[model samples]
Target: MEFYTKPGDYDPINYVPHQASHGTKELWKTFWLLLGITILDFIIYFVMPASGLRNVIFIFFGIVKAYYIVGAFMHLKHEKINLALIILVPTVFIVGLVMGLLYEGNAISLMK
Candidate 1:
């Protein structure tokens, strides 16, 4: 019998369930991808450019890493496209707003 046959049995805040293994190959692939992303992030941090361009590149890589983390490692890629968009839309909007604010703040500071 399934342990979590009933959906309500899972707690919203602290429920931890065993991950469904997608076999050894998938597990290895996920690990390798994660390692690669970490390396890329380290490289970016060391090669830091000016703030504006650096942030843009960092955010770009961050989004890519997030995509892989959510889609591949977390096994959500096969789900509906709308589900993925739902998770990302707010994040994208917030990032855009932050960037706009930063740009505006820099402009204001320069005017002084």
Candidate 2:
């Protein structure tokens, strides 16, 4: 399929230049926020004690980073809330499943 549009035949309704800058700003803002989260994760790695509490902190930061990355980079934030929720709900369920399995494994190991 031919992807390139003819020079004068561009569709302005579907692609508006004025609104494009807004998206760029959001992208950069999300990038900076994710970088900050990464820095915090690194700081926690060294300063926090190696305990379950530290694990929880890392998981919280990881979730925040994932939210922004998916929302902004994936362009889901621009879509309707229902559409975003449709994609996000399954993701959250999968994370829950993994957490449950890890908890069960720890419990079984402790019982032995």
RMSD (CA, angstroms), candidate 2: 6.4
- Supply candidate 2's per-residue lDDT for 5: 67
User: Candidate 1: which stretches are off by over 4 Å?
Assistant: 1-21, 47-55
Poorest lDDT segment (10 consecutive residues) of candidate 1 = 13-22
User: Against the unseen true structure, what C-alpha lDDT does each candidate score?
Assistant: 0.77, 0.82
The TM-score leader among the candidates is 2
Model 2, range 9-111, lDDT digits (tens) per residue? Answer: 7765665444344547888898899999899899989998799899999889988998898878987887789998888888768878998999999999999
Error of 2 at 62 (Å): 0.5
Candidate 2 clash pair list: none
How far off is residue 82 in model 2, in Å? 2.6
Query: Candidate 2 — worst ten consecutive residues by lDDT sum?
Result: 14-23
